[model samples]
Target chain A: MFSIASSELIQIFRNRLVLITSLIIPAAVSAFFVRQHETYADLGSLGYIAAIVLFTVAAFGLYATAVTTLASRRQNLFLKRLRSTAEGDAGILAGLLLPVVVLTVVQVTAILTALAVVAGAPANVALLVVAVLATVAMMIGLALATAGLTNSPEHAQVTTLPVTLGVIAMASWVGITGTENLAWLKRLLPGGAATELTMNAWNGGVAVTDSLLLLAPTLGWVVVAVALATRLFRWEPRR
Target chain B: MSTTPVIEVERLNLTYGDFHAVKDLSFEVRPGELYALLGTNGAGKTSTLEVVEGHRRPTSGTVRVFGHSPDDRRAVRPRMGVMLQESGFSPDLTVRESVGLIGRLTRRTDDVDRVLDVVDLTGRAGRKVSQLSGGEKRRLDFATAVYGTPELLFLDEPTTGLDIQSRDAVWATVDRLRENGATIVLTTHYLEEAQQRADRIGLMHQGTLHREGTVSELTHTLPGVIRFALATPVPPLPLHAVVDADGKVVVESFELQKDLHLLLGWAQDHAVELRDLAAGPTRLDDVFRAINS
Candidate 1:
């Protein structure tokens, strides 16, 4: 399993698209903050932006990565070939998810480090830790959820559009709108939980109250996504 | 013969929504035998092979690999290898990486170098899969299939898109596997492949097994082609079952010796010499066309 994971990580880095998405997107998003530093007054605001950037990288790195990889593998009959081997279904799935999970972790760490060194804002370790865990779970769930609907590798990008766009909208809009009426709707959204948790954490200590609220929906999405993916995920491309 | 068949499909039926892809299919492959499932496009050859490989479950009936159901039991997979019609390796992965990953899935570790050598891919093992040509990539796929030295191997259209040389190379590998006592289930549209490699051939048409027998047995059962051009345009004889517009007699039958003797007698009696006379056993291609039509 570790060997399979290592090989997968190697291949993911070798892929120009995956490489660009994992590294370039987060760097570009972080650069956007550096450019707009004068307008952001507080460390909390900067941390919020960092959280949004981290969330985006996680989505692309973990969720989008997983769905696209699985779709392409299915299209190429890689999943089918794996099924023929001694590797059980779990091992095969773990192998596919390994690269994305590792990339997500690396991207998140890079973003947090960039915030500390370049942006001159120290990270709240406890809040950052919780935020990172939530981001990982959310992205993995979103990926499995998206993979359930993707029938082919070619359709992977299009099928993932809904989640990608939804996360961006939720993360970007919650800060701008600040409308009380939208809180309930945004709370259920994937990135909304991370955004709120990051905002509370960046202010001081861990936001126990906000983190607790986000946990329910986060866990729910993860459970549902896993179930759907297991049921609907096909090993072979439909002819 | 061993008591346990390497592969057994009993009254298997599969349907894709409203369309019946395979119906009442049944066959058994013993250890050390090369079994060919010969069919045309959409003839359920792939569907049948998929079921045996546990990629798809039969809507009805049972598939057993070494007396274990492939759909229900995961234990049989380790002893089996498969070469799917379409490959699904990461384009960025080198041939060695792909083969090495497959090797890890087996109980016995296969020497990656030796497997690459068997497929004649040692030189290109470091090359990315995307950079390899069609034939080279196919060799890579074949290398992965046999990497584990699987006891039962399923090859679906294994030689498609391969150059003549590469095809022959794959055939040699198949021969080697058979010599090592591996049971192979192969599906191919290439009749000559089936004729050359199969210990027993099963003909499938319209989701049904139309015929099943050894290559020689099928040839014996199918009609032979007796073609001859006459010196003079003689009256059509009963032996001239099918006459071409150019006045050449085409006779199709199993009794080639008797037919040839009778044809000679008729020519002698009429003082007409037969030109371009040819008599031979029917090929698998001929048998396939005759049965399908």
Candidate 2:
């Protein structure tokens, strides 16, 4: 698994298009949000800015990148080649996704740290960590499910747009509108509950128990995404 | 050496929705022997190979590689090497890196540089797979499959895009591996390769095993041929012969030697030149052609 991960890391850096989309684009977008943190914070709050930035990196950097990578590999039969080895199916997937997952974590951590430094630290760092981890898990699951419907890296552009845009829109809605009017409806959506949890962690005063309960919906998305992935994901391209 | 089959398939069937890609096919590849599975287009050789390689599951029946299920990768894969019909390396990775990654995943260890040299790709080691030509990519695929020199190897059209020299090099490497008692399962369009190297062969047509036997056994079922262009028709003195559309005198003979001698004697006595005279036993190509007929 480590061998495959290391090879994937090498390939990620070597491919210019992938590097631009997966790393540079997400970093640039996150940097803009950080640079304009005061404006976004005033519109909602520092917590709102945090949720948007997290979703930006998660949607583009981790989620879309993962989908494109898997689609590209499957299109070229690389996944089939890998399976020809002694590695198990689970190990092959873990190896392929580990680099992207770890890279996204690092990018999110750095951007969030910068946000904390400039906008004052969150009220609860531990709760914020939980929110980030849960968000990453949910996005990764969705990426796998999305990859099944994608035929090539080119196809990923079309397939990924709905989820990427939906999650970011969800974060914006939950963060800006405060979920006050339709709280249950907002939380029931894929990213809505996670966005609210991020806001409570950063802005505080939401109660640890209440924040912890937000995890149920996010974890529920994870379960649903994984189930969908199992049915949808294909190792070899259609003949 | 043990005489137990290295690979076995029993009543194997594969279906893709409504299409029955492979019917009830059964064949076994014995140890230390080269077993070539030859077939016409869409003959289910690939589907059968994929099932044996564990890339796909059999719709019904069992396939065992080295006494274990082919899907048991931990047990079966480490002992086998597969060269797929198409090159599947990452385009962004260098040839060396591609081989190294796949080799490691196979849980087999060998010097990457040495393997590159075996396929004459040491000079192109640093080149990314995207930059290599078609034949070069094939050699790179071969390099990875032979990395650990596993006990069993699957060569799927291993020489399709290769030049003659590179093709010879690949066969040389396989020859050396066989010398060390490696079992091989091969599938190729080149019938002569199978005729020359296979200890036994399984011929598939329309998703069934059309024929299976030693080269001699398969070829003996068909008559040998003798052909010659006659400038002046004067062959009413010996064995029966027919003129083809090409205006060449053709004779299909089970007793090739006796018929050839009689034709030569007749030509000599008549003072007739048997232009382009050729006589040979039935080749694998003939056996293959016989299938459709």
Candidate 3:
């Protein structure tokens, strides 16, 4: 698995287009949000900015990149090549996605830390960490499921738009509006519970028990995404 | 050197929706043997190979590699090396990196540099796969397949895009591996390769095993040919012969050597020059052509 991940890391840095889309673009977008934190914080809250930045990195950096990587590998038969080895299917996938997952965690951590430094630390750092981990899991799951529907790296652009945009939009709606009007609906959307959890962690005044309950919905998305991935994900492209 | 088969397939059937890509195919590759599976286009050779390699499951059949299921990668794969029909390396990776990655995944240890040297790709080691030419990419693929010198190797059209020298090098490497008692399963369009190297050959057509045998066994089913052109019309030939459109005399003979001697003696007695005299036993290509018929 480490061998595969190391090779993947090498390829990721070598491809200029992938580097830009997966790393630079998300970092730049997150930097802008961090730089303009004050304005966005006034519109929503500091926690809201945190959630937006997290979703930005997750959607583009982790999610979109993984979908494109998998689709590209499948189209080129690299996945098939890997399977020709002694590695199990699960190990192969873990190896291929490990680098992207680790990178997303690092990026999210760095960006969230910067947000905390400028806009005051969150009320519950532990809860915020949980939110980040859960969000990453959800996004990775969705990416696997989306990769099945994607034919090529070029097709990934069209196939990934809905989920990428939907989650970001969900983060925006739940983050900016505070989830009071349609509380149940807000918590039920894919990214809604995670966004609200991030807000409560950073902006306080919510009960710890209430915030912990938010995990159920987020975990539910994980289950749904994983189930969908199992059915949809393909190791090789269509014959 | 055990007689037990190294690979086994029994009544294998593979279907893609409504299309039956492979029918009830059954063949076994014995230990320390080079078994070549040759077929016409759309003959299901690739599909059968994929099932044996555990890339796809047969709709109904049993495929065992070394007494274990082929899908049992942890058991079968560590001892087997597969050279796919296409170049599947990430184009962004250097040839060396590609070899290293695949080599490690095979769970068989060998010097990466040595494998590159085997394929004469040491000079192109640092070059990314994207920068290599078609032939170079093929050599790179060959390099990886021989990385650990596994017990069993699958070479799928291993010489398709290769140049003459590269092709010779690949066969030479296979020769060395065979010397070490490696079992090889090969599929190629070059019938001559199979004829020269295979201990046994399985010919597939329309998703079925059309024929299976050694070179002599397969070729012997078809008659050998003797061809010669006469400068001047002679008396009735000693053997039955047909004059083609170009005035070339053609004789189909099961007894090639006997018929050739009679024709040579006839020509000598008449002092008639037999131009372009060619006589040989039936070739593998003839067997392949006969499949369609």
Tell me the tens digit of each residue's lDDT in model 3 across A68-180. 99999999899999999999999999999999999999999999998888878889999999999999999999999999899999999999999999999999999888877
User: Interface RMSD for candidate number 1?
Assistant: 1.8
Please give the fraction of native interface contacts (Cα pairs under 8 Å between A and B) kept by each candidate. Answer: 0.69, 0.90, 0.88
List where candidate 3 sits over 4 angstroms from the true fold.
none
TM-score of chain A of each: 0.88, 0.99, 0.98
TM-score of every candidate relative to the true structure: 0.90, 0.98, 0.98
Tens-place lDDT per residue, model 3, B107-127, is 999999999999998999999
Rank candidates by lDDT, best first.
2, 3, 1
Cα lDDT tens digits, model 2, B119-232, are: 999999999999999999889988888999999999999999899999999999999999999999999999999999999999999999999999998999999999898777
Q: For model 2, what is the error of residue A39's alpha carbon versus the real structure, in angstroms, after optimal superposition? A: 1.4
Name the best candidate (by lDDT).
Answer: 2
Error of 2 at A191 (Å): 0.9
lDDT of 1 at B152: 84
Assess candidate 2 and give its lDDT: 0.94
